[model samples]
Structure formats: C-alpha cells, structure tokens
Target: MTIAPAASTSALSFDPADPVALTQALVRCPSVTPEEGGALALLATALAAEGYEVHRPVFSEPDTPNVENLYARIGSEGPVLIIAGHTDVVPVGDAAAWTREPFAGTIENGILYGRGACDMKGGLAAMAAAAIRYRRANPDAPGSIAFLVTGDEEGPAVNGTVKLLEWAHRRGERFDHCILGEPTNPATMSDMIKIGRRGSLTGRLTVQGTQGHVGYPHLADNPIRGMVRLLAALDATPLDTGTAHFDPSNLEVTTLDVGNPATNVIPAQAKAVFNIRFNDVWTPETLAAEIERRLREAAGNTVRYEIGFQPTNAVAFLTEPGPFVAMVADAVAAETGKRPALSTTGGTSDARFIKSYCPVVEYGVVGKTMHQIDESVAVADVLALERITHRLLASYFAAQHNA
Candidate 1:
C-alpha cells in the first residue's frame, strides 16, 4: 500500500472515531450493489486523514460489473488482525413504503433508519471507529490492525473480497486472524457471535413430459407426477442428524414451475429448484451425488429427469474455540454483561472465503430489519459495538507485547 496524502476534513463532518456519526454518513450514500456511491471513497478519505496507508483497488470480470475495494492499515508489524466488511447494500424494494427517506440516514428518537444501517454499514462503521481510536491511543501498537472494505458483497460476489484477498496476498499482505463485521446479533448488539456458517447448494430438477390435452386419459405423461415423486425422494430423509458445532443440514424447495398458462393442456416440462444449507457432514460433490442417488432410486429408469446444480462458493467452516476466539468472546461478554452464544446457525457469509486464508469469525450489531423497508440500528448499540471492538483490539495486541 502506498502512502497517500491526507484528505481535508471538509469531507468529514463528525469526529473520526464516532461510530454513530460515521454510520449516518455511510448510510446516506445510495451504494446499491455494484455501485460505489461514494461509500468506499468517503471511508478511505476518513481513514487516510487519520494517518493510515490506504489502497483502493478496482476489479473487473467478463460479465460482472467493476467493483472497488479498500485495504488500509496504520501500523506495520506482526500478527495483523484484519477487519472485513462490504459497503454495498441490497436494493430497497418499494422504496415509497419506507417511513423515512431510504437514503436520508434519518435518526428518529434513538434509532437510525436507512437501507444499509443494520445489515451492515453500521457494523463496518463501528469497527472503523474502534480501530481509529485504538491507533490514536497506541500509535505504535506491536501488532497491526487492517481494514478490508469491499463494494461487491451483495452483488454476484465476484470482483469483491475473494479477489481482494488474492490481490492482497500477491502484494505480500498476510492476515493472522480476521473478524468480519457482519450483523450476527438477532435483536441486540451482544446477542450472538457467529463462529461458523453452513454451506449452500442450489439445484434445478426438471422432468420431461409429452404435451397433450388434459381431457385425454393416456395420451400424455404428466411430468408433475414425476416431479412430486422426485421431490418426495429428496426430502424423504435427513442429510445428517446434526453436527456438534452445526445444526442439521436442511434442503428446501424454493420454486416449482412449469411456465404453463393453459389449464386444459399438460405442460411439456416441469421443473423444481431447491437449495440446501448443509453442515460439515458433506461437501458439494458428496451432496450432489447423494441427491442423484435418491432421484435414481425413485425414477427406476421410467422417469425422464435431469438435475443440475448452480455454481457455489459457500462451504461449511468453523474456527474451533481457542485462545483467539476466547479473546473476542471475553471482550463481548465483559462489555455486554451477557454470555453470547458461539453459534453457526445462520446463512453463509464472506467468512467462507476468508476462512481459507486465516481463522475468521463474525460479530456485530442487531439486524432485525436487514434489507427491509425501515432498516435501522440503535444509536447505543453502535456505540457499544465500538467499545467491544476496542476492547478486543487491546487484548489482541497486548498478547503480542507479552510474547
């Protein structure tokens, strides 16, 4: 990372380490997926002005839109702790239904409302504020703290963290451990800590049948019958009872469609798409093979069917309870006065990609209205998250001093 000149304070209205103010500024930006909307540049400028070396790398793919990501650090030393998050937010459906302006970053009474307030612009801002405070206090901390912010998480996930991590690695940036600032809490800032996430696999099951008049008895083979039978087979048994750290792998049918408009005519084709959130019990290959086995047994060489799975990057992973995890847990417990559950029960996140590089866990604010009409976060929760993050950082670098 090159040392860029400090930006003027004119762009930043609030204190550099104020999480609540920073989150409001971030939420005001309409950074819908794949759009910069000035979120990264705003944060980069703020971080650079605080004496951190910042680098913004824009990535591109054949079909996906270009994306910009930021990597910044204030210290150069051992045992780097990377804080990762995305600035892009999902599109707000029915924007008119929002109580406040979707991009205004409105603060009503005590709650801040905006599109990305909870599902995780707030988390990113909390960590940023905490890191800034830590650097100001310990200018030459023994261990380094780095921020990895991306703009393509809510998009196709291409040209984002996956590529950013690779680019950083190629440039000689190594991470010792990572704390992803995803919204892990269910109702409060200290509700939960996501230690791991399940894998995701989606497949489409299609059955071919001859189109004919519905009045005809034996003229056509109804694919709907075969589709129902195949679906039944897939759901007949559980993939696994439950893993020690993970819940039972679940498969749910998302869509059953024939695209047929006329009720009097039998559709020529029937298809059902389903998704599986699996545990460590199986890999994508194994899961697909198992589905095939079940479908084959039910088909008996009579049903004409084909099953195809979509490409996936999410895979089950866990960071076993250890010194590093304990450090984070201790920080949250001490700050919140509640012992947070070390859970792996939610949908997958970018941690699936980061886990390959280093041990990674996710902890952040409550996300009740994530991607909803009035997405919001409590002002006090953001402040608490900042404090917890600062405590964790202090503990992490103190260990290095002891070493």
Candidate 2:
C-alpha cells in the first residue's frame, strides 16, 4: 500500500510545541490497526521539518499485514533517549453510535474526540511536541533524540516495534534510556507509571472421545466431562500469591468449544482455551510445564487430551528502579505536583521487547476512554502530558551531561 501524505485540507501546519494541534492533526488520520491512513506520513513530514533525519520503513510478514513504521533521529552522539509509541488505533465499533465524527479531530468544550484520542495518538503527539521544543531550545543537546513510532501496535505486532528495533539495531542505532507513551494512568495523568508488565500465555486444550447417543450409558465417553474437570483444575490453583513489584498471577478461561449442536448426541471432541497473565515469578517455559502437570493430574489415566500453547512474544519484565526511573518520577512530580507511583500493574506492552535493549518505562494520559465510543481526551491534560514529557527530557539530558 502506498504511504500518502495527509490531505491538504485536513493537514494542519506542523507545530511541535502545540501538542493539542499535533494530536488533532494525528486524529484526523483514520489510521486504524495495520493501515497507515497517512498518520506516519504526517509525522515524518513534521519531524523532517524539525531537522530530524526521518525514515519510514514498511515491514511485512508472510501472512500479516504490511506495517509502516517511523524512526526519526536528531543528533548522533551519546546518551540517546528514544521515545516510542504507535499511531494506529483500534477499530471504531458501531460508528453510528459516536457523538461526532471519529476521525474529525473535533474539539468540543476543551475536549478532543476521535478513535485514538487517548490510546495513544495524543501521547505520541505529546512526545513529538516536547522533543521538538526541547531541541529547539537547546540545539546542541548532548545526546540523540529519536522516535520509534509504529503502526502494528494494536494488531498482531509482527511488523512494528519488534522489527523496527531489530532493524535499527542492525543499523548500529543504540539508546541509553527509552520511554513508552502508552496510556498508563488509570484516573488522573499523575496517577501511575508502569515499570513492568505481566507475561501472557494462552493455552488451547483439546480432549477427544468417541461419539455416541447421549442416552447410551456405556456406549461413549463424554469429553465435556473431562474438559470441565481439566478447566476447573487449571483455574482452581493459584499461580502465585503476589510479588513485591508485580501482582498475583491469574488465569482466565477465555473460550470453551464443543461444537455439538444436537442435545442427544455426545460430541466427539471438546476444547478449552485459557490465558494466564503471570508475574516475574515464572518464565514462559516453567509456567507451561506447571499447567501441563495440572492438566495431567486432572485428567487421570482415563481421558485422552492434548495441550498446545499459542506462540507469544510477550514475557514478564521489570525495569528495576534506578536513576533513570527516579528522573522520570521527579519530572512527573515537578509537572503535576503529584508523585507518581512506580507500578508494574498493567498488561504487556512493547516495553517487553524494549527492556532487553535498555531501561524503559511508561507514562501518559489517563486511559479511561481508550477503545470506547466517543473516545476523547481533555485538552488541558494533553498539554500537561507534553509538559511532563518535556520536563523528563530536560532532566534526563541534564543528568546525562553532569555524569
């Protein structure tokens, strides 16, 4: 797919100091998951205008959609600080239910409305605006400032940050510290900062049995009976109580399928799918083994079953509190007058992949409206986030210079 520039009428002038305007410009692009929708193109134009060497690389997997990503850098020296986020928003379900145009970037009573108003086009705009203002103020900053924006964040994530990071690494690009602008706050903008994320493991369990009449007492085996027992056994045990920096591990059964429509027929097969969000207490390998052991105990020697795990990229990770984390917390407090809590209480994010490269953390606007109808963000909060991000950059660079 061709990456087109934002249409002239919809394309507002690029101003990195005005995050609200930048967000509006971004919201105007209906860049739903896997579709460029002119969002990255618009960002590239804006970054290039700010003297950033911008690169838009389109990555493709065999069956997944081709994704467009942006990697723009300003400077070539030490202590590189990378700010990362995604432009793609989830699909707007039931468009007719929206109070206004989902892509109009409409501002009504100091609120901006759109599909990605909060989950995270607003945050992306905030980071961009802050970085531009910082660089403009201090032209010869000590280190490089780069953006790792991607389009596949809300999708399968195959052709986005993961690949972008690898691509950048191959090109010898390195960063000292990184910030992900995912909507981390639960209520207010200063409520929290995510230091880590729980790992996700999805398992599909299938039990096979002979098909026969339901009324027959000894003619057939009911796989549903075994499946229920197996699911119960999986759910009955707790993975972990709770770690100091992480939450208690939890397993939830997402789906159960028998596919038998007739009430009088015993189904030939039964399947159950469960997803476990675990803490740092267990690795993916150990967790999978524990689950299998439980299933075996539950099945006994009678039921024939097989279990398979879905291929996942998410793994539990933590960015131990250190100088970089303290600097970020100080920045948030300085801007918002509230000391943000260092937490690891959210779902997996791109940070899982980034932690292997460098220290990373997440902070952004409140997440209450993400993926909801009439999704919107307060205009003031967007500006505040920009200020917070600017403060973070300022403090980060100063600390780097002093060191």
Candidate 3:
C-alpha cells in the first residue's frame, strides 16, 4: 500500500543536531520504497531552517515509478563533499513477525528499533546531524556539503541516484568526494569501509526443445539435458584470479525452470536466470559476449538457444587509497581506536553513480539487522558515527583551507 501525504500524515519535528531524534522522526514517516512518506519534506524543512538551500526534485522514467529526491547544500565552492543516502527502505514483510511496530521507531534498552534504523535512515540522520554541527560551527566553511537522497534505491533504481547525478552534472556542479552513509560495517561500527563494489549483471538463458509423450523416446528432446551442460560450462572457468582490491568474479545460476510438472512429458522449453558479480576485469559488454561464446561453443549448433542481458549501470569502481581516503580513515580511527580496513567486498550502492563524478566511499552503522525483522541499531554506534562524520567534515575543510 502506498502511503498518502494527505492521509495518516502529520507535521513531524526534528533537531538538526540530534541524530537519534532525527532517525526516529524520519523512520516514523514510513517512506517505504518508491514512497515519499514525508521523509524528504521533513528533511527539507529541517535543513532549510539550518540555512541550507534545499531543492526537492521529482524525477520520472517511463514505466518506472516517479520518485522524489532531495538535493540540499550549505556552501557551494571548490572541492565539494557530497553526502549521499536514500530514504526509501525495503518493505516490512510479515509485519506481525516484528517485535514492535516497524515504523514506530521504538527504543528498547539501548537500541533504536524500526524498519530503516540501520539499513540507512539512521545513517542518513547521523550524516545530517554531523553536517549541521559542522556548518553551525563553521558558517563560512570551505568546500560544500550536499546531500543526494533518493526514494528509489530499493526499487528499480532508475529514478534515483543514476538520474540525480546527471541532473547535478548538467548544472555544472562538480564534486571532489562523496561519503555514502550506507550500513557498511558488518560487525562493529568501525570494522570496514567499502572502497569499491563489484559490478552486477543479470541474464536469462533459454533452450528450445521438442515436447512429446514418454513413450516416444526418439521424438522428444529434453532441454533440461542441455541446460545442465550449459550451466556447468558457465561456471566451469574462473573469470579472473582476483583483482588487486576485489575478489574473483563469480556467476551463480539463481533459478532454473522448465514449467513442466508432468512425469510423462518432456518440456518444450527450459529457461534459467543467472547473475554475475564481476570485478573490474570485465565490462558488461565483454562479459555478456563471453557468456554467449561459452554457450555457443557448448551448444555446437545442435541445441537451439536464446540469450538476453539486462541493462546494467553498476560497473566496478574503486576510490584508490589517497588523501581523501586517509582523512576518512583517520576520522574513524579517532573514534574507534582502530584503523578500519579499506575493503571492496560488498554489494552495489549509489556510490556507483557518485564515483562517475568524484571519488566515493561508504561508511555507516553496524548493518547486522538491516532489512530483517526487529531491525535495530545500538545507540552508542549511532552516536559514534555522528562524531566520526563530524570530525571528517571538520578535517576536510581544514585541509582545504590549509592547502
């Protein structure tokens, strides 16, 4: 069910300096995927009150849902630091399974419980809070602190960062670096910082065959036999020996379906869906061509087959460990007493879009509970991340000023 603005909605207040309160207020909006749920409106008001020039742009792509996005900035100058996030969260499946109301932003003991608590509403709040603090302290701070918040990240991803970045570029907005507040840490708040992400490609492969009764052995051609052979060939060879900062590319066949349940018949068609998490070694075009090569070689003109590749914008990217990387790591180390590892082992994020314009890395809350029932984040970690982000913001401008 889509959340309506005029129904079951009311004005919600927030303190720009308090992230926990911001998280609760934002989560309470129920901004489920593709729904505004007043999250952007609430943020716009808060940011505007803090003297930010806010713009709520509505983007649309044919066939996909039109989504509302937020782009707010305080200072516009050289070396802009774009803070990116999403208000849209995955749906709460089987709401009855949750220990508390998923959108209520309940707190138990020391944990904040809610749907988007850790997945990213909390992370986004922390970023906003930290930026507010920095801006209030340094009203004339050098560089820029802009937000690229979207409501389509958990959906088709068509009307979100991919388009928002283009909109920013069209207006001659240049970004020097980006910090995406996703729930990147797997265990503790300081375990890992995602420096890169593997590219993803999904494909559908179909094999054609003849259908006949069980009594006719010679007339029936079983596509299942061809499917098994082709599947093996696809996964038989290693895509690469692992990139310098990434794991070896891997392909997994997610589903295989023939659509025939009867025992006395041979299915006329067999289709399989597969996805690949590839490294920087291959582009989508090269990878698709290689898969076709393998299929044609294995089929050898005997098995009639078809292949189709889905459009992908998620190409592998890396923010090589440089001055910007060191600054962020220092800020985290200052809070955690340990240096976080610069890792490239994770699924995709909006960073893929941001990287096209500037160097982008990810850091946020402990993601153990994101997208799961009874999702929650520790109060300590949330506050700690805010402090870390605050330090990063301060140090970032200090460096720019000194330079």
Each prediction's TM-score versus the true structure: 0.97, 0.96, 0.96
Q: Per-residue alpha-carbon lDDT of model 2 for 1-403, expressed as tens digits?
A: 3333332333346565799999999999989999989899888888887788888888888999999998889999988999999999999999999999999999999999999999999999998999989999999889899999999999999989999999899889998899999999998988999999999999999999889998994899899888988888988978889888998999999999999989999999999888999999998999999999999998899889999999888899999999889988998898889999999986888998889888899998889999999999989889999999999998888888888
Clashes of 3: 0
The clash number for model 2 is 0
**lDDT per residue, candidate 3, 208-306, as tens digits?**
999998799699998988989888889888878887899999999999999988999999999999999999999999999999999999999788889
Q: Which stretches of candidate 1 lie over 4 Å from their true place?
A: 1-11
lDDT of 3: 0.89
| Model 1 lDDT per residue over 64-146, tens place | 89888888887888899999999999998998899899888899899999999998999999999999998899887897888
Candidate 1, lDDT over the whole model: 0.90
Off by more than 4 A, model 3: 1-14
**Clash pairs, model 3 backbone:** none
* lDDT of each candidate versus the true structure: 0.90, 0.90, 0.89
Supply candidate 1's per-residue lDDT for 28.
Answer: 90
